[model samples]
Target: MADFIPVNEPLLDGNEKKYLNECIDTGWISSEGPFVKKFEAEFAQTVGRKHAITVCNGSVALDAAVVALNIQAGDEVILPTFTIISCGAAIVRAGGIPIVVDCDPVTWNMDVNQIEAKITPKTKAIMVVHIYGLPVDMKPVLEIAKKHGLKIIEDAAEMHGQTYRGQPCGGFGDISTFSFYPNKHVTTGEGGMIVTDDDSLAEKCRSLRNLCFQPQRRFIHEELGWNFRFTNLQAAVGLAQLERLPEFVQRKRKMGAIYTELLSDIPQLELPLVKTDYADNIYWVYGMVLKDEVPFDAAEAMERLRKKSIGTRPFFWGMHEQPVFHKMGLLKDVSCPVSERLSRRGFYIPSGLALTEEQMQQVAMAVKELFN
Candidate 1:
């Protein structure tokens, strides 16, 4: 079998093992310890957030964000239809209705134009996902949210170190969430964090992250919360990864540019479109849309890539069509045309940190030949 290139891979050459050793030697291997604090501080600084609250995973970070924002039952939180389900799920978990809509065809993110139409009286927040490391067009989203009394929760899970209009991806929303999953730009084995500028929200987030401990006394509980804490071991690894985040982002951007250059003339595939102003895409997943007139289906193309040992996969089907959402009776007359079309036809291929120049070239060549 040929060597299989992956979509994403953790680069562990830096201080991962060294920090792991330090964590092990210190015996603060559980959720508590200094490493977590250090990681949170560094991460907040990276994103220009006033505070950072570490958590177990990206999902938990979102959940915490909603709760900190005081989202109540029946309240609506707007989201994109084409994205990882976790973005919407966090709202439901926090007792809010997830009002999802279509994203832009160009950016494959929230359609800022469509947002105003969906705003109802009950709308409380908006969860804008920075899909595939491309920040959502936030200038209008923020303006609309401000006109109404809606808060923005940025899902920056796939976009570490990505910038938009000179601001970091996570810095746009009132509160943003990040993932340190192994395959992310930065890895922590498994971890997440919430970034925010609101001191009250941050304080609420800090308390909520650790099971609502009373400041007056450690044992005394105030309100119910989760033990969604990031372990010292994980934080140690994250710190190491953070130190090299800039390099990772640069390499990803370079790889994306190379892919575009090589595949520019390929009529079978449609490359991603990043609007000039917010196009500082970190290229987390390297998504590619299939040409409307492609002879073969995107799924078939994915199979071809896999057969060549160059792994690829199709994009998310719109959430309303998902089995889970269907079960919730969300398969009604809602039409998010862009998301609906892209979901079935768009796909991404391997673009991990470990991909060498030769590997990237080979994959691009294979794609061209497969289509020809």
Candidate 2:
């Protein structure tokens, strides 16, 4: 490889520094400011949500959504095992049991087909994570939730601008969360947002993000809340990002095409799957499966790719099998064989914004060479 290609890099242009400097000059760099509200509005418009309330990070976005739903302790919130630990963390913080399930090997998203079987009297909600920019099939999940009156919390931490049934990913759920971390589809340095169609829920989110204050009076601490606020400086960066949303989505899809065209015939790899109607799969991080024919385990594969200057990441460690939850006796009868199996066998090389078609070709060729 001529140069090391990173998985993802934020495309910062068009007055990013100017906007941040403006925030500093105004001396309103703290959480509450015009830029914060402006970014929230633009984000809401871009994602097709009625409201968007900015917060600290993606985990906090989910945390505020779950807290607003008022899930009682011991209530269960179903999620996928093939995700970052933040989803489980939010559920635990909200006093709910994190009911994790395996993902479909093809989509690598929550096994929506298995969800109904897991619903019970204690089930309160379902958090759908659109992993790798492939939006989860939401129609069936929504139907299941409606029949049982369960809230749907969308973790669009990875899937921004992705659509399902002509609707944006986040808008499908009762409450949706977005992560604007540096590496996400968009960025605000480090920030998160919760969006919702319900005005009451939106109000609740605003209150929750601002330490549960009454808002009418600055010092009237209405309820116990945390400091989950986004600074104006971060918001300034996000505003610039939001303006390029269309171009960003377009570029992502184009890069995805490069990966698909090159890897289509590689039996050792399985590309990301999609539903027929979505018409969108913004490549937040393009993922692929290394079939059993490959000699090395996922860790070894990552090590090999690293030596070649091709960065790769292993699949998420299955949450049910993690020591953190095992200590709580959460996995006594959990037998998600697929999740556990894939966690060890699968590794993925991301197709990020910085990679050119030529770089992707080199990546694919390197992997093929390794398998031989």
Top candidate (TM-score): 1
Which ten residues in a row are the worst by lDDT in model 2?
Answer: 272-281
Per-residue CA lDDT of candidate 2, range 210-267, in tens? 7787847878886777789999989999998888777888988888878888778878
Q: TM per model?
A: 0.96, 0.95
lDDT scores in order:
0.85, 0.83
| Model 2 TM-score, 2 decimals | 0.95
* Model 1 regions more than 4 Å off: 217-220
Cα deviation at 48, candidate 2, in Å, is 1.7
